[model samples]
Target: MATQHDERAAPVPCALTPREERRSDLVDALRDSASVGLGAFPMGVAFGVLVVHSGLEWWWASTFSGVIFAGSLEFLFLGLVLAAAPLASIAVTAFAVNVRHVFYALSFPLHRVRGRLGKAYSTFALTDEAYAVTAGGAGRTFSSRRILGIQAFVHLYWAGGATAGALLGSALPAEVRGLEFAVTALFTVLAIDAVRAGRDVPTPVLALGCALAGRLALPGQMLPAALALFTACLLARYAWTRYTRTPYARTRRGGDHA
Candidate 1:
């Protein structure tokens, strides 16, 4: 048994200064988020430009970026708001478009975030790019500070770029013909990059097949329907693979035991 004085005398672990911890977290976060920030900035600028040209007030760009902070859904909101769609319609559409984020939360490293403010911001900034950056080898083990920093930086990139574009969009041509396709182009690039990185032919095949089926079955609700179908397909594939592999895995285990 140690005396109270001896226990008190024992060395305690050195705690990092708040500033030093923040600096370390910022540096790591910037390193991980730089690519996503770069990509999002240009897209955000495009969005702001589109918003200004759509006869909406310039402030709408900042408003949407700050409030929605959703890339694809923000684009759709432009048309919906412009059309003055029913509130119910907008609500449903927004949910359908962003339902994927609900799934994203299931695997996002949210538990690492501490404090109400940190967790709230983490949840708010849980974009696709953020998820992509922090879902793998080194990212999975990142500290809460680093995770929060990455999310903050990415969020800033979008908000800042949108504000800049809103300011500049007035000088551009009034009727930009192909601006709407930028979102589609961005997704196309992302898809190609994912395929290249994964080399997973079946996923893309399933995605394409589901998208086509959704378009054919319900053209107006294609995106949501396609996502639903794709999810089901993926789940089915997972189950089938697990079922088929378990027997072989058991046999290999038995052989090793023998």
Candidate 2:
């Protein structure tokens, strides 16, 4: 009876220690970010190659990768740097190019992460790839450590790839044909991927429509104009959804109660 009572009282399930739990979370994060690293690393290498071919110092590849850390904007910055575009133009252009990040914040798992610094870094490091990967991990219930680990891993992949490519590019011929087209190709691929994700269709539609209108209306200022138009449309959509949905929901609830 004593032996049976002891057996029955013993825990049936084993629990992971804190260290083991952390290790498991980190492994999961790494696995989740694996695809992102693959995509980012190769493109980063291309960016570094382009930077070197553009006659900029090799260190600029790693520098921009670490500081600006924005893939598309970094590509655009190469041209802007070479052309010596005015600071104001650069600022406005960068904002227009990257304004879509504002939308990513709406659904990002930022609230799950702890610590002000961790949250801040996650926000700063939030790229399209990171957002996509994290969104997919919504089912996994990502922990703070996992989220930070994924971001850090992606950041390393980009920065390390750029540094490596810069070293390799320095040894290659300066007149590399078609290297400059990398940015265009990257954006095209990104757009296609966004469509395929099937998250929302109207955003891309609004972007295309606004871009076309901007091109026709403001030839030299298409980017800024299109961005402005796109932003306005998004705001309008938000307002319509918020204001229109709430009243309808309330009315339906009231009628049901009545």
Candidate 3:
């Protein structure tokens, strides 16, 4: 019963959409995330080089990249986490900013995933970009190999890029200082692509509405607020559909597909 993610182009529903058995587009997407890491790490390295003159070695930055797994938020919170930001504040911020994820969980049909690890990693791989790819419905693969591969690819890319930047930051020039801006630009394009999809209208609207509601009602409770709004709407829609079915006219109306 396994289907390839790439086979959606055809109605047969057996082939995965990964293009090839071995290649991964998820890794390809990391080209952007990697650029962000490389650009930022060099700056951090430059700072370390200037202050301590030896440059950042490792341990700290790599751990941050691996564990934190967020780019902008990681940059902003690295210092704060090291400083005194309450754990609650960090949690609140994460929830509020990422509240839209709750909506994503709605349409994801994981019923076909086979084992515990497959399901676990599939959910784990569901990052912002991963979710975009999934909800974008690029290729429907019942086998999660490519999906999990994508996550692993991005994870490796981040670690490698950060390590490279941290080590080379001091030796790099100053004009390349703001390269991190490219990641933001890339994501802007991704956002535009997602908006143009047309099919995502319902999801995005629900996400935007929940976000607004969270800003007003929950403020710091982004995750909970988003979940509440999305759940309420989903439940309401389900109830309406369940209770209000239109009776089909038995008489010939349009005489066809109607």
RMSD of 3: 8.6
| Per-residue lDDT of candidate 3, residues 66-109 (tens digit) | 67666545655655665679999988766656656666686554
**Candidates ranked, most accurate by lDDT first:** 1, 2, 3
User: Any idea how many clashes model 3 has?
Assistant: 13
Question: In model 3, what lDDT does residue 101 have?
Answer: 62
| Model 2 agreement with the true structure over 1-258: per-residue lDDT tens digits | 234434334333597655677789899888977867767887788888888888888899999998888887898888998999999989998887887687777668898889999998999999877787776435238899999898888899898889888889967555445554544554566567656775788888889999999999998667668867888898788667756665435445333432
lDDT score of residue 217 within candidate 1: 100
Q: For candidate 3, what is the lDDT?
A: 0.57
C-alpha lDDT values of all predictions: 0.79, 0.79, 0.57
Ordering by TM-score:
1, 2, 3
Candidate 1 per-residue C-alpha lDDT over 1-258 given as tens digits, one digit per residue, 9 for 90 to 100: 535554344333596555666788999999877867767887788888888888788888999997888888898988998999998999998888887676676568888888999999888888887887775545668999999989888888888878778889988655445554644655566567667766778999999999999999999778778878988998788667756664335445333432
Pull out the clashing pairs in model 1: none
The positional error of residue 102 in candidate 3, measured at the CA in angstroms, is 4.8
The true-versus-predicted C-alpha distance at residue 33 of model 3, in Å, is 9.5
Poorest stretch of ten by lDDT in candidate 1: 249-258
